[model samples]
Target: MSNSIYDFRASRLNGEEEQLEVYRGKVLLIVNTASECGFTPQYAGLETLYRNLGVRGLVVLGFPCNQFGAQEPGDAAAIGQFCQANFGVSFPMFAKIDVNGDNAHPLYNYLKHEAAGLLGTEAIKWNFTKFLVDRNGQVVERYAPATKPEELTPAIEALL
Candidate 1:
């Protein structure tokens, strides 16, 4: 695995390959999301943050995952529609991915390794686990599933 997130490439909801290099100079909030999870409402706060801080170089990237309780079972198209219709999410969203286990996405594997969760464990416990990446593609911090999006503003501002 490469040292930075720029070394990764992920498929967008539309099925196009997206290079993380495109966001090289921007602060990023990368979250593993689940539409049916209890924390799903965080999507609204995430969208709000994206709209408010985006111009200042904060980009929120949502990655739907179903590894927990099968909370996000929808296909890419269905997930897109659910997000748009429910939370009005306008930020970039990627295809479904696994955040834990042997099948985890490479990008996510790097994130978990960079910033471990409570008790210094690397595995993601649930949906909505967020990884904050700096402009230089460094994984600076990892927010737990229950951490509200608003709580990240201070750290995000510092990076921006």
Candidate 2:
């Protein structure tokens, strides 16, 4: 795929549009999340990372999904509330979006193509899969579902 991660936008939980291009010049961690999944607790770590590094040009974007075992069945409003109450998450969260399937969001499709996972597989295995993008809008790395957000601090720091 083309190195055009900027050519995408996603619907915000608050019913607004967020252009991916607006994040230019920043290192980004894009994740597919699930509130009830095994990796759900990573939300706390992600928020910690975001809060600590946001001013350093690092941003973590969360996109909740139910594509895996119905782990995230809440609608936009519920998902937002749950995150705020449980994890104190303050990162930008997009509306519920499918990460794998015919209805998958275009931004995610680009991520998979740019940074395939284990054994060169491009398909996302489960929830909490992460894609790290560089400041130039290139997908630079892919982390597994179990990769905790805290584990990526070094990489994120290096990029910034």
Candidate 3:
């Protein structure tokens, strides 16, 4: 069995295959995003962090998910455009995925198993839930949906 995030592969927003191993040596902040959620504005903060610290080996990856109240109902092309137009988000975005179910993306399943949430629960509670992975591709921590992106700067910096 795979031990780290590097074992995963996902499709990019454009439908091209993306191997997580490409980001092997970087600090990763992986997020389950939704365009219409109340926390949607956090995209700006995520972009800011990516821009400021990206060069320092930090990579923020956004995975749009529609499982939460149908907040992200658009298809890949539309979702990509929405993020670019509304938040100017430039971080790597994967195709829309199910984050909490039998059909959950493999990477997310791995993440949840690695860092369970409050009370040691492995299920993701809502959109914007974040996972921080270290340079070695090990899941380091899981952030609740209410945890603002800016609040993760120190932890990200430490990993970088």
Candidate 4:
């Protein structure tokens, strides 16, 4: 596996295979999301961040994960609709993925390795856990599930 975040690829919500290299040079806010979790509301804040700072080179990538409480039970289409209709999330949304265990996605494994959670634990505790990637595709920080998306603006701006 490569060291950069751009070395991985994930399937978009629309069923398209997207090479992370496409986001190279752009600040990335990657999150493992869920529809029914308490933190699901963060989607709105995330969308806000994306819409407001996107022109400044920020992009939020949402990866729906069912590994946590089965909160994100919908298929790709349903997840897409719920996000768009509810939070008006316009940023990139990827297909459902496992954020832990043997099936964890390669991108997520890299993120965890680069920025472990509280106490240096690599496992994702729950949905909405976020990973920030700099313009050079380096994992810079990891945010707990409770951290609101709006709180990331300062860091994101700094990278932008």
- List clash counts for every candidate, in order: 0, 0, 0, 0
Q: For residues 1-160, could you state the per-residue lDDT of candidate 4 as single tens digits?
A: 5789988999999999999999999999999999999999999999999999999999999999999888999999999999999999999999999989999999988999999987899999999999999999999999999999999999999999
TM-score on alpha carbons, each prediction: 0.98, 0.97, 0.98, 0.98
Q: Tens digits of per-residue lDDT for model 2 on 102-128? A: 999999989998888889987889999
How does residue 135 of candidate 4 score in lDDT?
99
Between prediction 2 and prediction 4, which has the larger TM-score?
Answer: 4
Which clashing pairs does model 3 show?
none
Off by over 4 Å in 3: none
What's the best-to-worst order under lDDT?
1, 3, 4, 2
lDDT of 1 by residue, 1-160 (tens): 6889999999999999999999999999999999999999999999989999999999999999999999999999999999999999999999999988989999999998899988999999999999999999999999988999999999999998
Judged by whole-model lDDT over C-alpha atoms, candidate 3 comes out at 0.95
lDDT of 1 at 72: 96
lDDT of 3 by residue, 1-160 (tens): 5799999999999999999999999999999999999999999999999999999999999999999999999999999999999999999999999998899999999999999999999999999999999999999999999999999999999998
Model 4 lDDT-worst window of ten? 1-10
List the candidate 2 regions with Cα displacement exceeding 4 Å.
none
